[model samples]
Target: MALLVPPRSRTGGIVALVAHPDDESLIAGGTLALAARAGVPTGILTLTRGELGPIGDPRLATPATLGEVRERELAEAATHLGAGWARCLHHPDGELPWVDVETAAAEVAAVLAPLAPAALLTFAPDGLYWHPDHIAAREIALRAAALAGPGGPCVYEACWEPETACALVAAAAARGLPASLWGLEPEAFGSPTDGLPLTRVDVSEVIDRKLRALRAHRTQIDRGHLFATLPDDLGTAHLGVEQWHVAGGPGPDVLGALLGEAVRV
Candidate 1:
């Protein structure tokens, strides 16, 4: 029998699984903040310490201590995002794709099965920008959820609407900043605009919390980042909303219902 999760009113829990320490905040910080504020339990599962990530400022960490520093940062970020609990596994960062998927899935399943979260959010299979680690994270989350069969959490991929991704580049161009992201042109940065079920959560009220969570990952996101090029107001204008799609399991618009957002499927 499927485990009983709390209904759409959100009395249950939410867990976000991601490839790196900062990904939890980058992908669904606002939603996590909103859920926590509403007294819903929130959790984060980071697959790696992100040792291979950029050193936004060399002063924050050296090559030898980057992983340890990032682990601390992830804990702090989880606090800022209002996650009640979080854990980062000892997995290689950029080389996540080469990890043994079955072993990783079993490890993830061990954590998730106990919580039986109402929603499980992670990267899309395409990894949004096609990052291999992001793709691996999605696979891990899905397989973990599957291990629970009908009782598994509803899986969702928090992502940008194609238009939103395109607009970010346009906005950067308007400011005379680079108009590309991760070397991909604006036209290639987001999920396909195919007619998939979607939910747009208006997270304006908790945007500040999200910002703080992102800021907590100081070693990864510096002021020189594209998001930082825009002023706080402009950045918030874009970050205030988040997009998602249900990928598996029988579930309602778990996040939408929690935040009272209109489901735009």
Candidate 2:
């Protein structure tokens, strides 16, 4: 029989597994920041250095500079989120989807076994944006979560509900900001039925950290344009809220319900 525990009692230790450097910011930075603020040990596992990313400065995208630049950016951003450790897998960008899941899972398992976080976070099916690498990362994380075994870490997937996204776009438009590319098109938003069943994670507390982290990827995203195009209030109303599909395991909402500290939507 499963042992009972008090609500939000299991505290400390959380991990985020993603395909690229900036993915942590776009997808799960708020949750990361929340974990850090709670004094929980948080780890980030980046599958690639994002060498394939196209940037305003073409030179920054080259083989030699890309890795170093992205690594630095990732480190700085992770620091802003109060992340404890950041590990790079160095898989070639755009090529990760083709990597063997078992092999990838084994590598992830090795790291996770030692850290022993209470939860593991990752991408959902359709990859949030349908990027090939993102999809592969999801597969790898799912396998890794399984390999992590019972009492290891509960798994979670990033997800944006259709109704919520629509409301967000309306709010953005009211604030004179361009609707999110995906929000503008139903097809781009991906399948509604694909997300796993779980609780939504509110992230109002560390929204600024997420913004700061996103700004650190200057080559990929124009900070000035982001601020000018999307005002803080509007951005907060939209991005400050994030959701997750928790994979029930030995623990229920070990990270979200416990250390997450925000109301669920």
Candidate 3:
């Protein structure tokens, strides 16, 4: 597919709601960076500071200080993505499923009210990796989008192409990496079989920015174990395009128009 730049004349903005600090970068950094480069205002709303995530280096942060460190890292990543703003709810990590759903939805709705983003990007209902926090965030974002009504932003969810996921899993196995490392299970990581219609965005233009943003979260990502360990060709091929499912949007075509030719419905 040919790459197309989003029109600079487009007004309004995009807001990404995620469960944790680096979730935005991991899932949609390239798209966000591209939007920012196109003059579309962009922001991120992270529900948690990711305090419970594995610490790559003990010197960087402790259990007590991880939240603070992650907050700063998230801010730095947003800067790299050229996001107009980023906010954290500082909710306890790993506890989102236990939080009051209505209350969380209200808070998310409040954030969306003022931004009135053209689109709201978030994780799919399966939460991509089946993380409880991710699922909770997804529900909250969907409810918040609904509360915003017709005039509010269209909602999109990042999703993996089944073929792409299978290929990555095969590659990881070839490298002797355990299936658990990639979160694979007897049912192929518990991915939904119904599947979602995909909209592909060629993010080659802003891949560097995306990588930089990913690297910004040093506390959570071990360079050698995660990013660096991926076979370069496979990594490039997979990361070059970001995919999304129109979750609560007016229509897939509407979102395609907003994102331009970069979006393939």
Model 3, global lDDT: 0.75
**What lDDT tens digits, residue by residue, belong to model 1 across residues 1-265?**
1112223333258898999888888788888988888777888888988888888799999988998888888888888877878788889888889998889999988877767788888998778778899999999898888887886888889767667667766677788864434345556556764676777776778777887887788887666555544455655677777778888533576776665642344
Q: What's the true lDDT of residue 167 in model 1?
A: 75
Which one is best on TM-score?
1
lDDT of 1 at 223: 60
Model 3 clash pairs are none
Query: Candidate 1: which stretches are off by over 4 Å?
Result: 1-11, 172-188, 229-232, 248-251, 261-265
**TM-score of predicted model 3?**
0.84
The superposed Cα distance between candidate 1 and the true structure at residue 113, in angstroms, equals 2.2
C-alpha local distance difference test of each model: 0.76, 0.72, 0.75
TM-score, predicted candidate 2 vs. hidden true structure = 0.82
TM-score for each model: 0.86, 0.82, 0.84
Which residue pairs in model 1 clash with each other? Answer: none
| RMSD, candidate 1, Å | 5.4
Clashing pairs in 2: none
